[model samples]
Each structure stands twice: as structure tokens, then as C-alpha cells.
Target: MFRPLELFIGLRYTRAKRRNHFISFISLVSMAGIALGVTALIVVISVMNGFDNELRSRILGMVSHATIEGVRDSVKDWESALAKAEKNPHVLGAAPYIEREAMLQGQRVAGGLVRGILPGEEPKVAEIHNKMKSGKLTDLFPGGFGIVLGRELAYKLGVDVGEQVVVYAPEIRATPVGAVPRLKRFTVVGVFEIGMEEYDSGLAIVHMDDARRLYQTDGPDGIRLKLDDMFRAFTVARELAAELGGLYRVRDWMQGHANFFRAIAMEKRVMFMILSLIVAVAAFNLVSTLVMLVTDKQADIAILRTLGASPGTIMGVFMVQGVVVGVIGIAIGTLLGVVLALNLEAIVKFIETKTGLVFLSPDVYYISDLPSDMQWSDVGLIALLGFVFSLLATLYPAWRAARTEPAAALRYE
Candidate 1:
């Protein structure tokens, strides 16, 4: 019954008019500060998560999650290697590949790193085939001497489907006339785009048979595999590699993109730590507000003590008041954060269109657009931390209120 009354009294003192207008303004500002800081932090971290997801889908999606290659020049009994890898419980997909760095030149144009891939097996291992923008992955048939070009590489070479591109393998040798490059002519069969600049600018694909012929290999250079859970790709690769003996070696996506992914994770943590200071300051501001309220209500405190109110009860009153302010601000902030996180890309686009300024550019950033992904766990953690700090901030002020002496304060009055 008295709980509602206590609640009313608690809220009432929070907004009660006081001679110290500056202190009231500071309290209001502190609440707003927490709200803004939380919203901004949620939006930023969500966008970072979005970018991380984009990289996985657009970049990693096109690349192998794990690769099992022979430590020697080429993998022998490639069929056996493929079969053994597929038998693993964790392996979702597997494909044999002969990837070599070679220059592709058409007319006077040249592009780099012509990757030789098997059309049938590639689809099972990587999503690059699904991303073909023009023509078909099957167009790179072994019998046809055809190759697929990366979107940007296609643009740079100024070639399209049905055009001829010269592929210069590492067969260049010194001749009596001059330096000669071992080159072959292949028809461009298709163009693929994964929206990642690196792939588009530096990669090309050909039939694995064609690649083997170019490298003068009897079998595939290596085998690429995808796992049921990509997060476990590294562990699975390690176990499989060990099982297959020393002839085969394994490499996972984590090894290839370790530093980059680590940097993104590190940046996320650093940003959270820095932004949290803002929330900490806002939560701690309750101390000042409660202390000021206690000083203002000294006379009333003395009267309440005379009427036999315990020090504990007095402490509870101010403690509840401070907590109420913190709760209201955190609740509001969490709601705002959710809204911003869900539609962050749209908001950034609208702002950029209205102002004709790009906040993120494809040239500088990986993707052309903003991304946002909000985790409910992050919201809960932030709210819980704010509330805890708020409770901690109230102790000193609440104690000060509880320590008010009835006789001494009334005598002064």
C-alpha cells in the first residue's frame, strides 16, 4: 500500500523546484548525456557488426573456409584426398583446385592471378559460382578453354564474354631472342562480382584442367573445403591435416584473415570501453543530485528523525529516488538504441542524400553502404551496468541523509 506512496514521493523530490537551478539543469543534462552516449555506442557497434557480417558473406563466401594442400608440388591420388576429407563429420563441402598466379592479357590489357578452379566441385565448396553476374560458371568448361573474370578485372582488361584473354603462366624462360613468357589464349566466358574490392580487382578463374595443363601438373594443386560451422573450420582442418599425415597441410580462413578480424574485434572492445566512461560519468552524477537533495531537505530530515524514522529507512528513500532516475534514463536510451540499430543503414543513406556527402565510401570502406546489427545481450548488459553504477553512486548521499541529527538541525533552525 505504501509502496505507491513511496514511489510518488521519490519521483516528486526528483523534479521538485529548488533555488539551485544550475544543479537541476546538471541532473537533467546528466540523464540526457547517458541517453545520447548509449544510443551512439549501440549504433556504432551495430554497424561494425554489420560490416563484419558483410565481409563474411561477400568476401569469405567467395573464398574457401579451409584448404587442404599437399606439402609437396601437387597432391597425389587427389581422388583419395577428396574422399577422405568428405568422410569427416564436420566437413560440409569439398572441392579440388589448381590455383596459380598468372597474368591475363587481352589485346594490350593485363589482369593478375588467374585462379584455376573446377566448375562442378566449386559450387559445393564456395559461393562464387552463385555470384556470377553475367553468363554461367559452367561456361568455363575444360574442353572450351574458357575463363571467368572478376568484375573489376573484367572492366580493367576492357573485355567481356566471348572475348579472348591471354593467360601468361610462370613459364617465362630466357631465350636467344629475348625473354619469352609462356602464354595461352582463353575465351572469357563469364564475369562475377562479390562486392569485395580485392576479389574483383585481383582474381580470375579457369577450369582446373586448364590450370593443371598450364602448371604442367598431373593432378590438382590442392583441395578446398567448407565446414558445417565455419567457426569450427580451423579446428576441423587441424584434425584432418594431422590424420592425413605429413604429406597434406591445412589452412583455415582464421589463419588468412586472422589479423584483420582480430583488429575489428579489438576495435569493438576499445570503442565499448571508451564510450562506457560516458555512461559511468552519467551514472555517477546521481551522487551530486542526491547530495544536493539531502542538503536541501536537512530540516525535513531532522523532523522525520524526531518522529522515529530509522536511519535505514531514510537511506532507502534517497536510494530509491536515485535509482528511479537512472532506470528512466536507461530505459529510454535502450529503446532509442534499438530503433537506431535496426535502421542504421537507412538513416545514414538519408543523411548522405540530403547533404550530398558520403560518410562511407567504397574506395575507403569495404562495402558501399552502412550496416547495423543489434544484439539484445548488449542492451541488457548496458542497462544492468548503468543501474549498478547508479546504485553504487547513491550510497554516500543516502548515508549523509541518514546521519542527519534531529536536535542539532532543529536547534540551528
Candidate 2:
């Protein structure tokens, strides 16, 4: 219900030359603060999003989307499980695996998780073939006793391709002397690096038959499954578990790594809240700016009141001015945030090139470069919050302006 006269006067006051230069300086500072806060928030959130995606891909590369295992020691009928899983419309592939904890000794001794897999069927459920740094996944034939080691695990055991390592299984064998740990010497056929410390430092791969002989298991311990959509893994696992009639236990990637993802999500929320305070502080600065503006225009307010302008009209004029200032700041911030987030990776690369500095190195970190994935929804939410804070800041100052009495304000004149 604002009149054109009020709008025109508000805009004129905003653009007119100000007597107090400090007010103008403070206004500029507030705008810059808002812009900086928004830019940082957007860039940080985008980087986090990129990191989340990268970690997910690398993890899923080594692990399956879902897994089905017998409630007992081993799945004696794993072939049946694999066949049943493959029949599901949502299942893309399935493979059987046996895993055990063992001590591996080359020149040094190190403990690692020993996983047994079928070379022919491994690629259907996992991407181990693509991650091989040396040797082929098919090199491990039955009775060959060939093993594949993760890069860090190989380093820890001081063994490489064509080298020999002794794997001391947890199983016990009664020998002529006494009960001894069953051990076997295996040739290192391959080395793979998944870049994650947990897997790279503690995982070993060998033929399924060799693992069964070493562990004395009748069959594979579990069946791994790949789904058409990884996000539906939990639901698919539940259905598969039900179809198997409670004989097997089912799990999905999310359940296995819930803590890892939950931590990341919690960190993102905390970061958002912390950055929002910056925008809030800048928005609240509008209070001081408008208060000073109202004081400076006391005589003007009196003139308008005496000229038949209602208190509500006077309030609208000042409100418009404050809103204009906030809108301008918010608009500039939104523009800068979007631009900076989209170009953050390139900007980081440019800085590294110019400064001869390496922010991330593949030798030391999983990700070797800065990554960004700007989401429009995040941008929209930030912009909306900024606008709401700005609007709230205008209220008190506008109300004070409306309370000005014509007689008292004009007395000084």
C-alpha cells in the first residue's frame, strides 16, 4: 500500500549526497562483509559436495553395493545365493568371496585382511581389475597361490610383484611337534591402490580356492551384489534377505560405512550454521545505518508530516530505503558467490601454478586437486536467508522513523 510519492522520496534519499561520510563507509563495509560471507559459504559447500562424491566413487570402486552372507560360519550354498541375486531385476551382478584376518611376512611382517575372490566373476561385483597397478587380476589360478596386495600393504610387507610372502592363517593344525598355525607361502602377482588408507594399508586378495584351503572353509563366506542403482541397495538387500527366508544376513554400503558419511553430513551442517553468522552480522549492521539515516533526515520527516503525510507513509519511505540497501548487498553477494563457487577449482589451480605450491598431492592424499560441485539449491537457500535477515533489520529503524512527531522534529528548525 505504499504510494509513488513515498517510493520516489525513499529512492531520492538513498542516492542523495550524505552529510555524514562515516555512514557511507559503514554501509560499504556491511555490503562487503555480506559478499565475503556468501562467497566463502558457497565455495566451501561446493568443495565438500565434490569431496563427498569423490570419496563415494572410490569406496564403491573397491566394495560392492550390497552383500549377503550366511548367519552361520560360511555360505555353503553360495552358488545358489549368487544365482538368486542375479535373478532380481535390480541386481546387476553378483560374486562370492571369503575373507579372513592373517599375518603376511615378506622382509617385514604386517597384518591384513585376506579376501578370496573368483577372478572370472570379480569384475561383475567390484572394480578390482581397473585398480590394478601391476600384474593382471587373472594371474591367480587354482593352486597357483598367487596374491594381490594393496599398495600400502605391499609397502608395509616390503614385497612387490614376483616376490614371495608367507601368510599365517588363523586356523590351527596339529603337527608332530604341537599345534601350529597353518601357514602358506604365496607369490605376489598384483598390486592395487584404492587410495583409501583403510583398504590400501590392510587388504590382500587371493584366489577363492586358496583361501578356502587356508581357512578350512567349505565355501565362500559371502556373496557380493552390484545393483542398477546403488542408492536402492538397502531396499534390495532387504528384499533379497526376505526371499532367502532368514537363512542369510544382508547389508548395504550405507550400513557398512554409516559413520563415515554421517560425520561428513554433520560437518556440512555445522559449517553452514557457522557461515550464516557472518551474513547475520552484516544484515544487522543495517540497523545502525538506517538509525543514522533517520536522524539525519529529521527535518525532512517533519516537513513531510506537516505536508499531510501520514506516519505510515513516512515509515514506508524509510523502509524502502533500507530495503534498497539490503537488496543491493544481497544481489551483489549472490552474484559473487555463484561465480566464485563455479570457478573455485580453476582458481585454486591458478594459485598453485603461480606460487609453485602444491595444495594436494596424490602421493599423500586421495584427491590430488581441488574439486567443486556447486548446487543451485544451496545457492537459493543462502540467498533466501540473506534476504530474510536483511528484511528483519529494516523493521526497527522504519518503526522509529514513523514515531517522529512533527512539532518536536521541526522545533530545531
| Candidate 2 Cα RMSD (Å) | 2.4
Best by lDDT: 2
lDDT of prediction 1: 0.83
Which pairs, if any, clash in model 1?
none
Q: Which candidate is the best by TM-score?
A: 2
Worst 10 contiguous positions by lDDT, candidate 1: 1-10
The TM-score obtained by model 1 is 0.90
Q: Which lDDT values do the candidates have, in the order given?
A: 0.83, 0.89
Q: What is the per-residue lDDT of model 1 for residues 112-212, given as tens digits with 9 covering 90 to 100?
A: 78777878888888888788999888888776889898888998888889999988887776789999887788998899988887888788999988888
* Tens-digit per-residue lDDT, 130-171, candidate 2: 999999889998999999999999999999999999999988
Q: What TM-score would each prediction reach against the true structure?
A: 0.90, 0.92
Q: Residue 225 of candidate 2: its Cα lDDT?
A: 92
Q: Residue 250 in model 2: shift from native, Å?
A: 2.0
**Candidate 2 regions with alpha-carbon error over 4 angstroms:** 1-8, 307-309, 361-363
